[model samples]
Target chain A: MTTVPVRPPLVRSSDRIIAGVCAGLAEHLGWPVRMVRIGMAVAALAGGAGLVFYGWLWIMVPTADESAKRNARRPASPIAPAVSIAPAVSMPPNQSAAVGPSLWSDAYSPGYPSGPVAPPLGGPAAAGPVGYSSAANPAPSGPYVAGAPSQAEGTAAVPGTGAWFRVRNMRYGKEILLGAGLLLVAAILIARLLGVEVPLGTLIPAAAILGGAAIAWMQLDETRRAGLVDKTKADQAGGWARLAAGLALVVAGVLVMVSGSGSWEQTWLALLASVAVLGGVALVLLPWGLKFWRDLETERAGRVRETERAEIAAHLHDSVLQTLALIQRRAANEHDVVRLARAQERELRGWLFRDPARDAGQLSDRIKAAAAEVEDGLGNAVDVVSVGDTAMTDRHEALVQASREAMLNASRHGGGPVSVYLEVSDGGAEVFVKDRGSGFELHTVPADRLGVRESIIGRMKRHGGSAEINSSPDGTEVRLKLPAAAEDNGEGKS
Target chain B: MSTPALDGTAGDPGRTVRVVIVDDHAIFRSGLKADLDPRIEVVGEAGTVEQAIEVIGRTRPEVVLLDVHLPGGLGGGGREVIAGSAALRGTTKFLALSVSDAAEDVVAVIRAGARGYVTKTISGAEITDAVYRVAGGDAVFSPRLAGFVLDAFGTAPADIADDELDKLSARELEVMRLIARGYSYKEVAKELFISIKTVETHVSAVLRKLQLSSRHELTKWAAERRLL
Candidate 1:
């Protein structure tokens, strides 16, 4: 009933700053990873839900591609676990489990456990196939977890019970400070619940101190992850403004908490007033903020589509438009006339429709490279369209060499656009080089001028191929043909 | 918007063709009109989407020299104009024009019901010939467009998509490849030992097959290439 079987695996990513719990979550939820991180930080600091949740994920979630392969190899694991251990994890097992977040459960529920313990079953609700959701927490038990999927068995394997208590990576300083603050938060909350006379002023600033500490802790985590410690200036919060503000907020919170009982009425009034003002400000700036981000995204999308045309438009001004201005000033020479037309053609073809990726295979690539050489030095543009190709063969030499000569001659005499079309099939390979120059009679060309013509024709003839030259006032087409390969010829004889 | 004065070329072959120029460049549009064969009358001109659609709808010219890129109405370009002129598809034909043999925009316009496209680098006489061909119920496929079409349809008839209309006849494949290899209709005819008209028919049939395919290999090929 669900597309759960088709969904991507719920794996923790290596691209992480903290445990990658929120980052992986953000990807699946289509929320900004930053927002998810902040939300988790808040969740962790305020109630310790996020910290427990993240540690549980860190132990349960596989690190990357390695775990996915392991999951694929374990056949029949999901079924036995579903039958034997389904009831173990499904706390308060009921029909409600089947109904809520069905898609979410489907992805995670089916995963086989990484540990030596028999793979844990999904919630009892998902019957036909295991549907695992983050909500499907395994009943806490001994010997169920091996080390996290990241570490090998021989390494310092994390014991199952202590997995939630992180001791490695020695973030000793911040860890102690945050641990004490969380203890203080728990103490305050417990005292209030026990009717231990905790005042509203103490509670408010106490919460502030913990929140500020959490924000700073996360920022420090990001910095250390970036490997910018001690060298790169504090820049994430716009050059030390954020870190200082965070530290200052923590200090101010401490001071306010120590100064002791302010009027409860005054604190409530100030809190409501600040809430209203910030709400009004957010409402006022919301449209502009949305527009700013939207405009940035729209510009990024347009940049790709408009790049070719924009380059052409920019070059049209740089070359062709400037050439017209030069032509007007020069009152004309042959060079200027030809230059103007060439510039225009360059502006049209070079800037506009030329896709360098158009060429494929050895023959087309070599022929195009030859054309590029002529165009770069002599300034004649060639358009090449290739249909099919074969692997490189000895027969390629006559075809490529003849095509190059035809191209050079076409540029020299044709003095206009040249086009080459290459087609290779089982029968044979053929290349057509057509030039838009006033045609020449092949025989009328004197012997001395016949070098290129004789070379093209004679080279093809020598290689068991043939060349045809058709010239007219309109254009000239050099037809070069290579017979099919030796294997095909041998087959015909047999 | 503008409509240029036309000097009747009654002596020229066949009837005079009425065409609307829809390029955003005023200079190129004017120069093209000025240099075009006398047999083609410049019926109207426009530089943006609204004007092109308005001009085309008002004049209902026999052929529209539609620019593949435009500056208005969500930047749909020539495809947008062709889409706007959907009602006039029977009466008016679209001949796409662009600076290069830009495959996507040309394919977009063609898929949006344009007959075919020619690059701006073509000779004035050739453009006139293309316009005449469009007006006479023929499509213009430049060598570049032919190359693109050939590539788009080159994959074997996928047994995966069983639509009969998506298949091209052997004659059409031969015609398409020849055209892609820069063979003019006459040359292709001579090479294949068929009449020039038969080559035209095969070319038209290839375009029709591509247009008729709602979902198939050709559509998938073009979809993968959809900067269109």
Candidate 2:
């Protein structure tokens, strides 16, 4: 059987006259609604403080609608995975027995119906239930069917009870501490007015303990949350809470040091004592803060390295690995292998060192460079004549490589004088490698030859352009053209 | 009834089909010339698109064996030669010869008013037959390249949305279709029976109406819409 998820406590909109506070408390504490009402009435008869408490609860406890809205607005945490619920089959039969008297007593009452056992507090299971129940019930009345708090309501009630030790619970903790401190101070002032003496030493230590506890609680929460020690709600501490707690600690430390001193004349000693006390408290807190800082730095560096590694892997897969696979399939002889190796080397070197982002140099300059390289390598006399200076930075490498291949083929096969012509137009850039050589029939070109196929034609096609080879007994000409813009139209014919 | 020989080749002078070979490759041209039957006389030859236009204009060959990718003709290839020599369109037929069988290459040349396209891999006898078929005013293409022509030109041009064509006037629309199908300005003028200057004005108007930058883009746009 599927386990029913526990839901958060929310004020019942349907069950209350003034406010849903009594119904919400009754549901959350598992006490009968009638019993909670009787208790509240008795407290109200004794003094009007119960009414004030009820008023505070009404304001603090969100209505069902408000809780639902809050749950919807909360952003999903990137680092936190969705909490998973454990099956109810493994749950101990007496699990409800461990719940405190505040709510557990109602579970075992002879007259009471056996309700669903409340989820174990402050565990991953508790977090799971709140989120799950909200998702399971699209309407507010669905939670009432189960006689349990709605998912949003459960999350709302966590800070007041189940999640009291959680860092996020401190939002309400500060108010409670402030209220208690105010009551204590009022009691002392009233006693003094009634002619009773209040000792300064006793008051100072109490204030110190309260101040130190607040500061220490905040510091410990920061460290524990930073370490993700319990993995229970990693809620961030509010900026104001930290600031207020820090101020309280400083004030309490100074006051205690000054009051404990016997003479006002020894001002330096008292000041030094306050500083020493503050230093001791800070020393106790430093290790956790230091660990958090170091962990954050290491995590950031690791993420950067991971991103860089992924980029490199993608680039290699797209280019080098593909070429290697093709080479393995097509290599027939030593000559074919050598040609493939040279091509691979050129491609690898370009990928490693060429700045693709930089603007491609002039078309004329590229042609000249290609021609000069061919002449120097092959000892061929090449005359280069360039007419335009169009820059094609995007496909610059492809065009240059194609032109270089054309030049290499000419120098290798052509008879005598070779001429390279470069022209740039609005449509595209064109480079012509013309040689006065005995031209061979295109169809007669052996399949083993990689010079014309892979080097010239394939390069241009890869760059979204075309190559034209025209050869006759008069001379051979290779016209390499690159389109001005590369528009990928989803046809992989290239 | 014997006709005067066009190039003074011996044997069956009266029955000879005078032809010009317009390929940039000299060795291929020589091989093709040596392989052709004596009945097919070689009248003139040119290497570049400009030279092809000049020679074919002067020779007035019955068939021109044109290479699709010739340089030096206003940045256009074999299409430019057909465009430049518009007056000879009626008397002379063009049969494109190229190494590429790519659909774009086949479609571009055919749309430019070539009578046929044959890859260089075709046997000499097959090329000879294609030339004769083109000279007879019947369209011809290698078996593989025929699909490209059918896909491009055989379809009804009405596949494009009405809104894309609504802005263009009748004359502008006609010019746009031809130009987008890869015909140069001169060829479009010749085909439409308008002057080249008039074709230019209509083309620019169409370009403005359709917001196309160039003929290359226009061809791609038209091809994408299956209007060609």
Score every model by TM-score. Answer: 0.54, 0.27
**Candidate 1 residues A78-163, lDDT tens each?**
23222222223322224224433432233223332221221122111111111111101222100112111122121212232132
* Native contacts recovered by model 1: 0.47
The per-residue C-alpha lDDT of model 1 at residue A22 equals 76
Q: Could you give candidate 2's per-residue lDDT for residues A363-423 as a string of tens digits?
A: 5557765765665566555545443345546586788889899888887898554666554
Model 2: lDDT of residue B135: 67
lDDT of each: 0.63, 0.58
Model 1 RMSD in angstroms: 23.1
TM-score of the A-chain for all models:
0.38, 0.30
Clashing pairs in 1: A105-A131, A105-A132, A105-A133, A106-A131, A108-A132, A109-A132
Give per-residue lDDT, candidate 2, residue A23: 85
Question: DockQ, per-model, please?
Answer: 0.24, 0.01
Error of 1 at A305 (Å): 14
